[model samples]
Each structure stands twice: as C-alpha cells, then as structure tokens.
Target: MLTISAWKRFLIWVVIATGLIFALPNGFYTRVERHNDALAEIEQLGATPARQEAVAAWPNWMPATLVNLGLDLRGGAHLLAEVNVTEVYADRLDGMWPEVRDALRDARDQVGTIRRIESDPDVLALRISQPENMARALEIVRALAQPVVTLTGAGARDIVVAGENDVITVRLTEQEQAATDDRTMKQSVEIIRRRVDEVGTREPTIQRQGADRILIQVPGIGSAGELKELIGTTAQLTFHPVVGRTADAAQRPGARQVIYPSIDEPGVFYIMEQTPVVTGEELVDAQPSFDQNGRPAVSFRFNPSGARKFGDYTAENIGSPFAIVLDEEVISAPVIQSHIPGGSGIITGQFGVEESTNLAVLLRAGALPAGMTFLEERTIGPELGQDSINAGRIASIVAFSGVLVFMALSYGLFGIFANIALILNVGLLFGLLSMIGATLTLPGIAGIVLTIGMAVDANVLVFERIREELKTARGPARAIELGYEKALSAIVDANITTFIISVILFTLGSGPVRGFSITLGLGIMTSVFTAIFVTRLFVVMWFERRRPKTIEV
Candidate 1:
C-alpha cells in the first residue's frame, strides 16, 4: 500500500530537480540580473566585445531571471497625479471649429456668414449674421455629431449643439465626457509606462487611481522631481504652415492663426495656422541626431498616412516657411528648399545633447491625452530599503532555523524528512516567483516566514495519525497508508481555505498587500505538494528497500 509507480516516482523527482534548478539563480541574484541586462543590451545594440564578455560573466545555459524587488524593497520615486480631463473637452470643441465652419459654409444662403466668438473655455461659440437662421446653422453642425461608443454612453451623441439668439454653442455631451475620461486615463497610464520604460528601470507600477488620478511608482529612480521631469513634458509636436513673421507679441493674427515667440530669437515671433498638417501622433519613430550645423536635434519619420499628407503639403508649399512647434512654442521656421517627398525631417533648435535625447524619448512615448497635475510626490532612499531587506532576511533566517530544529527534535528521523521537504518547498516557492518575474516586498518576506511554520503542519497531522493507528491492530505499512489517508481531508480543507483568502487579498488589495498575498498563496501550493507527494515518496522508497517488519512512532 505504501508504494509508488515508476512514472509517479519520476514525476516527483523531476519536480524537485526543476525547482532546484530554477531556484539556483536567486542565490546569485545580482550576477544573474546583470547578465540578463547585458545580454538584452547586446541583442539590441548588436553584439559587442564588452557586452559579450559581460554576458559570459554568467553562463548562458543557467536561468537568467531573478525575482524583481518592489519599490519598497529597492527604493524609488512615488507620484500621484490628477489628469485634467476637462481640458480635453475644450480642445475637442476647439478642434471641431474648422469642420463646423466648412459644414455651415455649404448652406451660406440659409445660415448666413458665421464668425467665431470668444465664450466659455469648454464651449465653442459662433455668431451668425442672420439671427433667424440660427436653427439652420445648428442643424448643419449637429449633423457632424457621432454616437458615443462607451457602454455608459448608450445612444447619446458625442457633441451637443444648441442655438440661442444668433449664437450657436457646441459642447461635449455627458456621455462623450465619460468616454473621454476613460480614454484619457488609459492613455495617461500607457504613456507614463512608456516614458518610465524608456529610462530602462525594472518593474515600474503605473496604475489608475480614482477616475482622474494616476499612481506612479518607479523603482531605482532617485527622486520624484526626476520622475516628474521625465514625463512632465506634453511633447505635443506639430507642423503648421507659417502665415507670417511678427515682431510684436501682442499682435492677434485672426482666429485661424496663433502668434508664438521664437525659441532661438527673443524679439522674433511667427504667426502660424492653428490647424497642423500632421502631428506627432502619426510619427512612427524619432531619434536624437545632429543637424547640418552639428547642433543637437531630433529626426523623426511619420507613418504612411502622415507621410503622404506631409509630402503633399511640402510639395505644394515650396519656398513657404513652416513652423515646427513644440508645446505651443515655435522651435524653428524653416523654408521648404525643395519638393520634400519623404515623410522624414529634422527639428533644429537650441538644444544640448541631453535635451535632444529627452525630446526623442518623449516623442517616442507619445503624448498624454490630457495634462497631469502632481498632487503628491515622495522619494524613498536606498538606505531605508536596505535596512528593511536586512531586517526581513534576519527574521526569515531565524524563523527557518527554529522551525527546522523543532521539527528534527520532535519526530527524530521522520522529522528530518519533513525538514528536507520544507527546504525544498521554499526552494520551489522562489523558483516559481523568479520564473514568473514577481516582485517581492517586505510583506512578501513575512509571508515566506509564515509559510515555514505552516509547511510542517501537514507532516505533523500525518505523524499524529500514524501514532493513533499504531495503537490499533495494524502493521507498519497498513498504519502508514491509513495515516496519510486520514490526514488528506484535513490538509485539503485547511490549505484550500487559506488559498481562497489569498486570492481575495490579491484581488482587492494594492501594492504591498498584493505582494504578501502572492508569496502566501504560492507557499500554500508548494507546501502541500512537498508534504503529500515528496515526503510520501521518500517514506515509500525507504519502506520498500528495508522491508521493515516493525517501526517506532
């Protein structure tokens, strides 16, 4: 009865061996992590001698991954930002002005001449020459409205058109606002993630907090200010046709054009068309490079649609100056020297090497849908993180040693087998963590130490069951089999209940709490496996080899 088939024995040993193999790299975590990073860099930049040597520092055949340390463990910057979703509403309304003008122009005889009027920042207002024809104008503009595609939007339109007196007002409807908010938040999170990843930090957490706020935690970043500076620039790059150059800052160039001062020259200003031919959203790639004058600059390539539009505009507007605007400021106004057919161009400005590189990174990450205001920011130092790690390490070692000694003293040789299984259980836990690239925090360490005590509970239950069965009229093999059989129900019930709790914590909790839940949940699984399968296989092998007639409890 206390026997295992050949296949079962192989499976049991294979699991142990696999766990050991994966767990081995964690013992040399720093070396393995550096090796992995070096290999990645080499692959990206083409294999170089130095990088090849760095990769050789750790063998290629070995497991290269290590459990990522969390912000609490590694020390980093934390920021809570609120996105200005309302600003996007204003921009969306402003963008529709051109289309509204063209649509109303078609029925000029009925709607009369339309002139833009200053109104609320979030509303588009237009004054019609003929007061009685305001309804006709509103009807033409409302035809441009599209249904909001969000679940909450239902049948509502994206824009609401209303006419009062001679003024036609356009504003984003409630449904559209809800949809915009969702898109803005998702875009903000994604852009923030891209910006952070560009700096090559490991495992940064960028998540949405409420409806309009974002929580960013980037490990290994020195300060919150640094993190803010990296992602703060809206980086809204656009190419607009230059209407004319102006020296006066106060000069208003109608509603269709804007006046912006030159970055290189303080006194000079450029009046550029508000509507851009192509925006950075269409850019496929951007990189830092040097211009003809050896000045730091950024070169960008547009996507196919953008390229065709850009090429057509440049070919038609040869010899006309075009403004390269960055965040509403004019970077440069370069005249088209020839019929530029390619979608690629260079942005030349007063930039240092670092500034040019930063610009390239921001452009590549894409623009945030809306601006963000930092509500809270803080930085955790590496010293504090190191102290936490040291404390956790000491605690784990103490708990593990005490448990090992107690189990050995309590059950003699049988207890030693449990101890062996316990060590393997921990090894298996780390193996899974590393393989999955889970982040481990201080709370996670507590979870591991807690697991050590619980790991032995299963063995204790079976050992007690065997002692009870020995008192009955039964041989060693029959008693052992019955012991395992009786303990199985209690083991399953206890572990399953605990595993369910871990799942709940993981689902509901954030950050550190989730980390704790992960280790605790993983511990529950590994402990059960080593306890029932690994420990029993050891006992079965020993019993079969010795042909024991009797055994002491």
Candidate 2:
C-alpha cells in the first residue's frame, strides 16, 4: 500500500496534467470578446444602412477560423510535378546553340562540305565522309566544343565506314549540369509557391520531396478547379523587342489596334501596331477589375525609369500605335491614345473571371522563373476524407473499449483502477492536442488510440512487480515501494526507445507520417505520468480499505 504521501503525489501529477491539457487553448473561462466600438463609430458616418452592412462584412474585422484538414478528410488536389531537363536542354539546343552552329558552319566553311550539317545547342553531328577532309573537321569541332564535351564520335575511316556516320550527343556531369533533381525540384517548388500565392492562397505549404518532386498543401482553397486547369501550363515569359508597333500602326490603313497573346486571348491579330519600346518587365504592379467605364480591364503601374521612358516614347510618337504583344500575339494595339507618359495604362478587353485570373497569375509570379511541366496530379474529394474520419472514430472506440475490458477483468479491482487511469490518459491526450493548437488528422487520432494500449503497458509492469515482490515475502508498503522502484527502469527504457523513434520520424517523415510521430511522442510522456502516479495511488487507497493483499499478477 502506498503511504499518504503517495496519494498527494498522484493528485498533484493529475492536476498538472489537467492544467496543461485542458486549460490552454483559451483560459478556463476566457472568451474572445470582439470590440465593436470601431464598427459603431463607422456606423455613425455611414450614409446608408446598405453601406454599413458592406463595411461590417469585410474579412478584416472577422477572425477567420481556418482549420487544417487532412488530405483524406478535407478533400484537396494532390499534384506531382517533374522537371524535364531534357526539354530544357532541347530548347537550349534549338534557340541558343549558336556556338555549336558556328562550329559546324566554320567546320563546313573550312572543310568544304559535300554532306549535311546538323547541329544542336549541346551537340554538333555532321557527315563529312571524305577521308582527306575528316582531320580538319575534327580540329574545328574540337576547338569550339566546351571542355569535358568534345569530339566524342571519332575514330578511323574503317570505324566510321562500318557503321558510324559522324553523330555525337554531348552531356555534362550530374553535379556540373542542370537536370531535374533536388535543386531543380526546389526551384520548381518556389515558383509554384509564387504562382499559388499569386492566385491569393494564404498560408500555403509548398515543399520539395526528393531530387525531382514537390508537395503542396493549400488550405481553404476555392479555386481548385482553376488550379487543375493551370497545372501543366509552362507560361514562362521574357522581354523581346516590340518589333515597331508604332510603325505598324502608322502603316495600318484601318484603326484595328494590336495586342499580345495570353490566356485572355491567345492568338495573333493584325492591328495598327504601336509597340511600346519597353516590354512587360517595366510593369511594377497590376490591379484587375472593371475599368472607369465598367468594362473588365487591367491597370498596370510602371517603374520610375519605365514611366520616364514611356513619357519620352509617347511624346516622340504622339500619333503612333502601341501594341501589347505577349507570347508573340497582340491582345490589343489601341492607337497610342495621346501617349501614356505617366508610365501607367489600362488594358481593356472582353475579359471574364477566368481570363482575368490567368492574367493576375501571370503578373504576380512575374513571367515564370523557368518553364515547368506537370508529371502528376490527383484531385481528392471531401467524401473520401469524411469516410476515413468516420472509420477512424469507430476503430478508436472499439480499440479503447477492448483495452478497458481486458485490464479490468485481469486485475480485478486493481485492473478497474488502472482502467480509470487509461481513460484519463486518453482525455489528457486530446486535451493536450486541443491546447497546443495542433491539427488532429485521421492518422493522428489513430496514433492516440494506439497510445491507449501502450499506456497500460507501464501499469502492467508496476502491477506485476508488486505481485512478484509480495509473493517474495515483502510487507505491503515495502512491496509497493519496491514494485515501483523495480518497474521504473524497464518502463523508462522502453518508453524512451519508442520516443526516440518518434523523434526520428517527426524529423525525417513527411506530412501525415509526421503527425503520427508527434502524437506518439506526446503519448510516451503522458503514459509514464499516469502509470507512475494514479495507478500507485489507487493501489495504496485500496489497501487501506480492504486491508488484505496477496495476489498473482
């Protein structure tokens, strides 16, 4: 039997646990009282009741309740995207391989080519079959290729004649080269984050997985379907010459104006072109809504230099046309209506919500940092998440009940007492979760349920220790003390090992797995507290009431 001191220790432990678990998210009776004085003051100035209602409905005054829901429970879009370095390299080969082309051209010019010349940005392959001319060809090609990538497909005339026509593909070392790996994946993650934020997703969690992937979680998303539409669009932008829109417009026989190609209208059109000498990069900000005349329009502000340049350009070409060319298509080429020298202008078009959103996404992410391609995407519905939550709750109830019944039957009154500790252990777990403001995903709830079974393991250790000691002829008080002392090492070592694994998991695991580890870690500490104090106190009190004690654990 535990002494009076033992009972006091148990009660203090319980009280401490309750305070941490229960009294935290808000104080015991603390309410979030909203101050309405500002609203009342605003109402005093309101011109009409309708206007006051609009002011009251603004999100700034309301504290939004944003709960993080599990991927399965809350329903969301899951996407997997891979960086295609092959395509990037291919593009480099197509547009920027001037050195390779020049090498082939110079090789041809020097060697007097009778065959074909095919050169990509990264590789130059040709069929200079004349044996006498091959030596000069290799020398010219060797002089031009970047170091570590030179004259690969080379050999004797016999080797060439047998099967090899001059065809060589150059590749760089993995670390020294650009490819779809962790670094590229991380870049893609940042770009995607920028894109999602451009669409106004607050508090999005975007992260990279390995060398070639990203995981994104967007909470309280309203534009999920729009996200699906945009997943694979590689809308990277760069500044190119406006190609003399003013000249084109002045040359135009009619008043049709030029514009650029974008999601708003992705096709070229013939207009009186008045191309701005400056490109879109000069734009500092874009606001979308109805124009002064109530038509959908985008208002753009320019940098200081851009403003001055705009003023100068418009001043010079007062009667000229300026075209807004995007992706090589003109959306609108309104005649430079009296020169927008202020550097700010409006893009008025037949735009709806979808087109406006796409335009906003473009202006916000700032012409994509690089091109992207989607390699994976999955849409999750809320129904699936609801089903999973329902199943988890049922399983928890069944698992918890089984634990209570087994502990009670096996240990009699002592088992029943441990059962109460078990109940308190679970209550404290949720209370802690609620207090910490931690999200309870389905996996997290299951982790708590599993913790219940493990919680009893510590008490079972103590109970069996006492039974063993009493059987060995110790007095009740001595047996109880020895039992607790002997059980301490085993209990701690076991829980500590489990807790270590949980820590490792929380550090290394992703998403839901981390949730499991977090709850498991919390469980270990709480289980030890409940087992050491409450169970021992119950045994001590029971001995005082019954007075006879001898049993097999």
Q: TM-score: which candidate is best?
A: 1
lDDT of 2 by residue, 1-553 (tens): 3575855876757666664545233222112111222344455444456545544543353332222355665666666655564554444333323454466566565555433344443442446544456666656544543332223323211111111344433333333243323334555676677777665443455777665566766643533455645544544322222334232323443321233443344434344333235655567877676778887777777789878877787777666555565555555665555756678877667777567657756665554334545566666676777798788879889988999899878877778888988777766666666556555567777788879879999988988888889888977778878999999999999999999999999899878888788789888877887798777777777777877656445
For candidate 1, give the lDDT of residue 161.
90
Model 1 lDDT per residue over 248-267, tens place: 98898977678888998889
Provide TM-scores for the models.
0.95, 0.62
Candidate 2 off by > 4 Å: 1-67, 86-176, 179-183, 194-210, 215-226, 230-239, 244-348, 352-358, 365-372, 431-445, 472-478, 533-553
Model 1: lDDT to the true structure? 0.90
- How big is the positional error of residue 111 in model 2, measured in Å on the Cα after superposition? 22
How far off is model 1, as Cα RMSD? 2.0
Q: What lDDT would each prediction earn against the true structure?
A: 0.90, 0.61
